[model samples]
Target chain A: PQNNKSVHCHHPCKNIHVFQKVAGIVIGKSDVKSFPDRKNIGVDRFTFSFTVKDSPDFFINVTAWGNDGYINLLSGSFSVGDCVVIENPLVATKDPEKGERFCPTTPSHYRLLVTEAHSQVYLCADIDTMDRLLPLIHLPVKDSRDFYSLGDIVANGQKLDGTVINVLAAVKSIGEPKQFTTSDRRKGQRLEVKLFDDSVSSLPLVCWDREAIQLVQTLIPKETVLFIADVKISFDSFRNSMAATVNSKTIITVNPDTREASLLFSYAKEASESGALDQDEKPEDAKTIINIVMFLDSITDVYTVTQLKEKAQENPEAFFGITYSFISKLDLDSSVSKVIRTRCTRCKLQVMEETQSCPNQLCPGRDQAFSASTGFDLLVDFTDHTGTVHGCALRSPMAEQALGCTTNEFTMLTDDQRTAMKWKFLLERCKIYVKILPSTKMRTGIRGVILACTRADPGEVKQHMSALLQRL
Target chain B: RQTQETLTKKPAVENSLRILTAVIDGMRHWSQFKDKVPYLFEIFATLDSAVTVGRHGAKNFLMRDGKEVVQCVFYENEQELPRLIRGQVHRCVGNYDRSTDVLVCVSVRPGLPSELRNAQEAVKACDAEMRVLVKSISEV
Candidate 1:
């Protein structure tokens, strides 16, 4: 009954329900600005620019004005390179006097305005369109742009006059957000964050007002790449280093879609991987194993070899399960020969038989009595009709399960006996569940190492086999 | 006296047998044969020469049905397969092989019935065509 109503648009004002929606990818953003309203109360303005999807040459500028709540929502939701749709928008012509003076440069004459009550902005999830426009969205800086590094600013110790410079860096650390009273008795928040680039030196970036509080609450240092635009450079005499002061017109982008941001991300990833940074300074992916372990504990979603490969390529940090039929033991003789090795229980480092102690000084076994444990490295080939993969199951628990014997008993067996046992237990024609841990060497690559292996329940396998047989 | 007793009971047994025969006829007509048993039949316009391997006592053959070319493997445990002659239609039943894209035939019988003669003609029209719809055995 509600759908039967006829929609009508009024003549003078742009009707809220009849306006055409604009679809494009965000390419640039301006800094947040506050202006006085009719009652002299301050309101925030958030503006961004985007290129039309069908016509990339045409750029549209969007201004969300007069409401701090709507401005904050837009600021938190929209980012560059995100394809978005703004519905029921109010299109207005740009004033000639304000031409070229706007912060985010746009090519089109028309501008769009959206408010919380009259408009809606939806971030598009079209991955293909985003991929196509990814490399095309260039920053609006000049071709001969001379950006200064943190090292250059610190060495110069003096500000360059009438020059606006940009710095592309990753957030290295963040200080606690503190509230401070301004000269006019207005309460404001301040936060100091450390930023690093490909250079050897780093800069201390000070943010004030709402931005400081937002950074302290949302940003994860060393993981978030930041592009600081139009910030005034100054020398901190007390620390004797260069610092950048964030102001009302300074635009700060977190993980923006730009070549420089990607480069900084790769640098941060490399630093985290090479152990050049501290343990606590590692990137978010370093904690993926713990997240995956927690995720796998609650759910059981078995993936095929092909599905596992595709999923691993998408997100290599997540653990996946593969149901595979046992093929054959690959390099059985070589694997069994080096199966048993003495390792420190605490450090898991291979301890030499002569030392009779753990080599790692930090390990508890170094000071205590020698606590040795046996470990195994078993590699086998498995297949699931669709594809074949080499599964490497390491350590004692997996070895005990695969060999059907305890590690102590296995160590006491002769080499020939171990080989025989491997042949006997590994060749069964049954379905098995294998947990795959992605290799760190190839990020977003398909190859994974088998972390654990266990035979599936016979009853469940029978049901699966019957279902498969019916399909066949 | 025993013959006389059997004769007296024969009519009742015959009546029950007639009802059983009617039920079997209804089931045969209503139920699809392919759905009951996993079987496939294909007419081949041409078949490759069968090669017998001594190691596994297996014979491998390649044939083209209407849709695609399929490889057929028969083991010693199954009945021996006659030599594949070109331009002759044969019926095959087996599980599908996903790995090698082959049909592992358990039973290969030569010649199509009169009802399937049109299928044989269709195969002849399209040279080296696949006529079978067997699912892959490795899928199981």
Candidate 2:
């Protein structure tokens, strides 16, 4: 008592001894209460409570406030279970009974400077920030809000939604024709596929189209990026987990959206890891895209030189050369020409002539589009047993070679390899179809030509065209 | 630039921690530890409003600078304690009735040591109840 001296300063606790700092060990802490109050000095006090293990049977009262001018500096993101260390504690007290003498308690008069703030403290409230808050490990949102109704749970049907999420797996079976069953109980074609990821290697993907199914026969799991958007998930008969059911409505293919593109890029990287890449240095279906090319055949009609010219009216570069010459010979009405267009996949420049460079130097995707002098006069659309159609054009020597071919030869697509060749040579508009092609040499020695004007499916067109294709 | 901005800002919990720690450390009469201070106590109490206990009660808490805290009630009991005092700070000095037993504690936080409040609550519970009067040392 003799050594006690009254001192005045900005804070009450600043004059206290060093040994009096800090109470219990930094152990488990919890929130008991938090509220707002105003001090007699016209300052606001936002009170908070914390429970500690070692010291103090009574709860610690902490007022969360600063001077009036600095109130805006506080963060609103604080939450429960956040472990915080306080520096420079202060305290104050008051009379418990109305008529009782006014008394002060040492513990109540304190100010603590908060040191470290962790975002994990608010993890429960902000599910969206998990990636930014959590470090190192990759965590996918398993709260069912992000899932696209497609695919199944990797683990057996455990808790449908929980924090302990580990694997996000989807069905990857190549559909087998034997498994194809329509809602009417009619059997169609199916392709079986296996699910795969770089994390776990590979699985199966089931494609229902005959050409796609046939192509899947030779496809390695590593070389495909399946974007099953509206795939509805159903409980298996065993009720072990939810699985994907592909009907005619299932769009089990890659799309151009960022999410789907990212999936494919990763898938391609995974395929490359498994030696799925060919000598040609082409990216395995699942590889990241270094570049992209976008061309429109027709919004309403199958793409043709006339449609391309109309679409390409903005730039002569995409239309003038081979596609233009072909359009000039055809007795196409101007209305048809306006329906389709071709432009640089990179710069969207309308290509005009067969040249190595575009008129706009910055325009990429610039290359000799087919050839200028040599133009294809014949257009053939081929449809397979599965109802998917693909179209191709033949000109000069190739058309002459096919002029005398029989219908059987012209429409022959006996295997998946042939389907892939037609797709590789004639079907550049579709990336997903190219990714599903079978990996075999059967298509290396094939060609087809048709004299009759019959429309066919794009998927079948890929199968019928057997020509040892010029480089695409 | 961000670091500079952060360094200039004052902390949020400076007031409560300062008041709590100062009284706990100043108290010297407890049989459990050396001197009158036998044991150490740290209590965490949260009232709905900072003024839930009123200006007199807050000032009284500040007056006990170094004494063992007995019980701390954070929740309100309107039926138990009626006619609570209105908590006010930074008003004109002449308006306050300092001559009487009731005096509003308007002192700013004295900036005390932090660890004093860190004293265990269990230690404070073990102490004898000593009534420490709350009185204004200065007009401000």
Candidate 3:
């Protein structure tokens, strides 16, 4: 702690000598400002606001002037959260005549000037202690001035004659980067990115030149939330929609340190994973159904119950297809009835037992078995060694195959024969494919629907048992 | 054309059967018994810990092997569960609950391993108790 010695520097104080050090967290930074000196040469000034360790509430503005390399290093290496100790800094009063006191717009009466003679800047490594003082460093809220939601910007109709606005949004989708010729005949790269806000409305953002290249390098759709500032808005006549164009001054921050950015990223991730964005608040279009079919077709791995439970936690609304062998049926309660029934083929409405007529009035045969189908609802408990879960095998083509005979044939059999059939077929060890749908209601667990079932071959089961014994 | 189709179909069917046989041959644990009949096997484990909830809720017990912990959920059915004293070795078997995040015992029988008599003697020397659920044994 050699440099831990405290020095007293306060308001109405004299300028400090060279080699004096001060430590603080960099709270704010201004864009590079250029000015012409007395020699008529262009000079670049970089200003940063910091809350000193000695007086946490008092901000001290630090201004540095240098060449491109020095300015770039100061801005690039240090960000808003960094704690730095500037060595050999000159504490100076602002010039009232030139209005330099208001140059950085900080509340402090005095400022620090860093020049070539005293430009030793040390970035501090002790962040844990500095984090405690972060509450003292106050940054003015700029959301009202700079930030605009897509819904608000659209409703305002400010882009009628092309207005530039700042927005904080998450990139929902991005097109492949492509090289294109600019209107000036120069070759440049451009890409189209779709940005969405909490309003659920989306707007197209076009990134050109260097920004497009940077976006291609760092942007991950549905994961990266960006803070895009000062983007030019233009109405596309052909599409009859508003779009944002990236220009040189547009400041693009990927995954910025902001609460809104984190919230937007999580929302985008959940919507994308659960397919909620497509299914919710939209008509049942062919495209939406096709997306679900594609997702179902893409599933190839057979997951155990433990894996399925974890998947349910990650995306609660998504359905997972699982294959398991039948272990046994749980003991039936009073609610479960061992009754055979007939149902309408089209609507699946049950028919009267005595008349064998469809109960549904819309059936083609008003009151006859000709328009109805026969099948039974079964709830069987299954296990794959990991856990036990109950699944409903609805009366479908797969259920009929599992039962070994058509529902109509089973309905015609005597009660004694039906009981024997249940023992021979339903109670036997077999493979069943089921689609497990997670319960939408909180804490209700998962529900499974059997899609297909097949009996286990005797020879294969024998071979499997032998191999399993060897492993044990 | 019909003969050529039948020749192609015959080889495809034979190839499928060969693949099915290979898949069956790879079966080891109860977790691998998807679409296949389950084989009864016993697990010799130390009952390291136990957690019991309300009267209606199932009791969760743990058996550990330093690296992995197999959780057993014991439900009170027609038969009552024998008191499980901790840190004692026991041999048990029942249906495996694969859907659970942890390894669970759908049912279990407490007994000495018929195959590993010497190991059972060692476990008995360590003061292991027989705490089988009677219903699980009866069902098997």
Candidate 4:
């Protein structure tokens, strides 16, 4: 207990007068941010960060600042993946409000500030030390197996929204890097890559870091399996879905020696061999989207339940087909939690928690008054006498329109009224337009996104069935 | 309901009960088999609003479309079932008591609702399915 005094401060934060040395490999380095002094008339201050990992479990961010000459010389002297040693760096508590978002997350509560004329950073000259440090680069910050599959992320919905998580998937496609200027006039670039596994068909992973984007550019899609650790998963309100982002804390391990990665590697190899990888790359022409609305009259390609099952096995990027379904009962008696999905208006990227503070670091309303949006986000399985298709994402505003009640209005119904209200449509012969994607064979299931669900006139169902039966 | 789970696993126990599809038109014909075997049946019908709750946890129900009607009684002592709304079609699976001609219920699943005029159309399909299912049970 007597030696525990420096536990909170470590060696760095307790006293600035003491001399200390830290050695590690430079795992990540950032570009410089040069800005004029707000109070001073002419002088400019330059700053940047380079993260160094000394041990397999420990890493710290070293933020440096000086005039343009000192900053450039220091940043240009070494590159990412280089081994470095710092002597007499000042350790201080991280800025509580901005630190978590601004810098990479570290186990320690403090970060080292490299000041001019006092601290020094030089490449580690010892071969023995460098040998031990460089191999740590292959290690992930989190366990490789501790990752969420693409389907698991979507299934969790907004509960996992704005939370950091590890992911295991193969790269489906990588988009060309696009350059832009931030509103603050700083230059920025983003490269988006689509990832997929057996469970989910497609998901987007966005990289804003120059280092990360560069590493991604060299990779071949479908041939590569990535075990991305500490990646931030967020609800993209823009797309009304979930997406992953590579951040400072994220460390991507490319095709590591792990059972999960090798299995995914094999899946990537098989999916590519069939040439099913690029099926989703080209967006179907505008006419296809419009057909979702004009489905009844315009679209004529109808599939039976068995036909839908066979098409999923073909592994298309996504296939659109019309099916006449009982869409009935929805196996109601589904627990209330699955029946109604509540999202924080402040978190999704939606609402906050019981406390005043929103847990989502990326939330726009993080510091504001808490508010929420609750709606029917159901996974209505479509079934007939033949087979069943599970978990078609039926979310609002489509859910509200199909249920014929506003989310707010639905909140007022009693348990009996809710059951009766739901029974109104669940017990109806329906015309359903769905977009299907193949799922992991682990669960012999397919994921369907219902584009439109309409209570079909029973006569229309009979007519369609008769037509389908004739073709069969 | 827990006591009847044997029907799900035992193949011989399953062979004796045919899940005959029924419509209101001629489901009365199924009563004749009630004295022969404790067979299962699935009937597509709608409930009348007038429900009578009896002592000993018994509840009485009517499944009818105008003149076509059948009586159903649910006797799950403690468990309360999901209340199905009136005029909505449901598939009720149960056994018929030979003495009373009452459908003693096990489970009810909400089904696709159609007009009473469509009831004849439903009967035509069910009659064909019933023949095939009944033939399978008799052969076994």
Best by DockQ: 4
Clashes of each: 11, 165, 7, 9
TM-score of chain A of each: 0.41, 0.21, 0.37, 0.55
In TM-score terms, which candidate is top? 4
Deviating ranges (above 4 Å) for candidate 2: A1-137, A142-274, A277-343, A348-354, A361-472, B1-140
Work out the TM-score per prediction: 0.34, 0.18, 0.31, 0.46
TM-score for candidate 2, residues paired by index: 0.18
Model 4 per-residue lDDT tens digits across residues A1-472: 0111222335542222243777787877677778897767699998889777877777777888788999888987887678988887776666657545666666656677786767899889999988888887766667666889987887765456668999999998899876655546566787899898987667789999887897788778988888887889875533444689998777676766578889999998998888776674565322223222333233356775556877887765556677866563453344656667667653452332234555666555444455566666778866543345767877665565567776667767676677666555553456787767777752644778776687767676556545544443
Top model by lDDT, which number?
4
Worst 10-residue lDDT window for candidate 3 chain A reads A330-339
Per-prediction fnat values?
0.00, 0.00, 0.00, 0.02
Model 2 chain B weakest lDDT span, ten residues long: B13-22
CAPRI grade of model 1: incorrect
Model 4 stretches astray by more than 4 angstroms: A1-19, A35-42, A182-185, A237-241, A273-453, A456-472, B1-140
DockQ of each: 0.01, 0.00, 0.02, 0.06
lDDT digits (tens) for residues B1-140 of candidate 2: 88988866522211100111113223322212222211222222221122345443332222222232222222221112222222321111101122342222222222112212322321231221221111111111
Better of 1 and 3 by TM-score: 1
Error (Å) of candidate 3 at residue A296 is 41
Question: Residue-wise lDDT of candidate 1 within A216-298, one digit each (tens)?
Answer: 45778778776666677753322324578765445455675666678778998787667565653453332323322332343
Which of the two, 3 or 4, has more lDDT? 4
lDDT of each: 0.51, 0.28, 0.51, 0.67
Question: Per-residue lDDT for B1-140 in model 1, tens only?
Answer: 99999877542210000000011122223223224222222232346555556448877776664445666777856235666675565655454544565656655656444414333222221111111111221122
